[model samples]
Target chain A: MELSVIGKYKLLVARLYGELDHHGAGEIREAIDRELMRRGVRNLAMDFTNMGFMDSSGLGLVMGRYKKVSAIGGRLIVCGMNNNIRRIFQMCGLQRIAIVADSLEEGMEELDK
Target chain B: MNKMRLEFLSRSDNERFARTVAAAFMLELDPTVEQLSEVKTAISEAVTNAVIHGYDGSEGIIVLEGTLDKNAVKFSVIDRGIGIRDIEKAREPLYSGKPEMERSGMGFTIMEAFMDSIEVESAPGKGTRVTMTKTVEAEDEG
Candidate 1:
């Protein structure tokens, strides 16, 4: 998987591409965490618009990041999930912990509120 | 029915390969996008279980088999590695055998949700086999 992280205004936006599975989660997690720590970013927004496939591992990645951000009084927003990904998120009850948005713009707006 | 089987090392990198092969094999069924995604997700979960829980970071082999019938598809992921002792507890949502790894423990739950039926057979010292099936609704031709 490929990931791009942009940090601004104390928020980090990660755009993930390709499939996310156990094989890729560890590296992605480390990369994101590095960015989060280096920039002292508070809130996080994950853009899944280009992600074509995900499984339970994706849930683990999101949950782990949520714990990290929330512990620091930051918010987590997951945006641009396809119907299939959304189903997995709902099945895992991810909506309970992370803010679900349709797009990155919407997620940023929610973080502002 | 058309059938195919693939055996690969239980490495983390092979997880995506296994699921993608399953999806390609199921194309014979001409499943809808949603149906394909569901089957792919289920395959991913089962293969991941074999890689992570079954082998436990050690190198082993994972066998993925796919069968396509008139309106349904079946898949089996098998591993000859350490198996779960308690199937019931393992199937529970949010129950990770390796919590330190930050696993969501939703593998079995996702498999059950996407597939029409799921069956798991394992012996603690023997191995584990997960079989899942999904029925595809035939779309009307225009």
Candidate 2:
């Protein structure tokens, strides 16, 4: 999967393109963590608009990232989930830990709150 | 009934390959987009379980067998690797044998949720086989 990370002020928006599977989550995790550790970057917004497929592995990726941001006293918002992804999130209870937004703007707004 | 079997290495890269092949095989059934997605997710979870837990970071072989009937599909992901010692415990949500690997441990749960029926058989040092079935009702056309 290809990932584009843009950090502005305290929020980092990482948009993922392609599938989020075990094969791809590792690289994506490292890339996102690298940006999360950057100075002054506190909140994280993961954009899934371009992501076509995801499985339980993606759940692990999101849960792990949530732990990281929580450790730093920051929060994580996941946006642009398709119906299939929404079902997975609901099944895995990811919505309880991370903010689930309908769009990137909504997620950023939540982060700002 | 139509049947196909695929054998591939337990490498992470083949995860997508396995999902795509399963999707293609179920096309003859004309599954709905949601059904297709659910089946793909179930297959991915089973295959990934074989790759990560079954092989445990070691290279092994995984066999995906698919069969199609009228409006129904069955898939079996077989792995000749280390088997789960406690089947009941492993099926629990958020139970990962390799937590350090960042596994959500929802693989079995996802497969069970997305499929109509699931059966698992394994013996330690022998192997494990996960069989799942899903029926896709034809959508009515106005």
Candidate 3:
């Protein structure tokens, strides 16, 4: 798994590459968490554009990060999800917890709110 | 119907390998991209469950057997690990036994959603077997 963390304004935009399965989830959690702590960033924006596949383990990664970010009064946003990933999110009822935006700009706007 | 069986170690990385195997098995049917993704996702979840939940941190053998009959495919993932005590509760949405591990507990939910039918059989001390089937409407079929 590859993670590119871009610091845009106050949001930490994390772009994930490769498939998001059990193996990828571990690496991503550690990398994202370390970056989040290093920058003291609260709001998180996850970009799944390059992600080709994702199982429920991807859901755990999102929910786990949501818990961490919300604990510190921050919000979590998601964007650029493919149909497969979006269906998983919808089936798991993640729309209530995480804001789904069409683009990175829209996700940043949601975080700003 | 053509059939094949595979046995491998219960490990996280094998999830992708297992999915690839399933996808290859469906190549003969010429499934649509969407149908192929659904089957691969279901297989991934089942294999992952065996590695994480069935074995419960120990190494074990996972048996993946699949068969293609016309336009439908049937497969089973068998693991001789710690079997679930409550099958019904386990099938519920967001009911993961390993909450601390950040498991969303949507494994069964996703499997059921993507496949046409799923049957889970298990005993507390024995093991668990997940058998699922999906029928694809080949684009070339009249």
Which TM-score does chain B of candidate 2 obtain? 0.98
| Interface RMS for model 1 | 0.7
Docking class of 1: high
lDDT of 3 by residue, B2-109 (tens): 999999999888999999998998889888878888888999999999989899768999999999998899999999998989999999999999999899999999
lDDT of 2 by residue, A1-113 (tens): 34444465377788888889999899889988987776457778888999888998898999999999899888899999999998888987778888899998887776666
Task: Give all candidates' CA lDDT scores.
Answer: 0.89, 0.89, 0.88
List residue ranges in candidate 3 displaced over 4 A.
A1-8, B140-142
TM-score of every prediction relative to native: 0.96, 0.96, 0.95
For candidate 1 chain A, which ten residues in a row score worst on lDDT? A1-10
What is candidate 3's CA lDDT for residue B82? 88
Ten consecutive residues with minimal summed lDDT in candidate 2 chain A?
A1-10
Better of 1 and 3 by lDDT: 1
Model 2 CA lDDT for position A83: 95
Q: Residues B8-108, candidate 2, lDDT per residue (tens digit)?
A: 99999998999899999999998888888998999999988899889987999999999999989999999999999999999999999989989998899
Q: Specify the highest-DockQ model's number.
A: 1
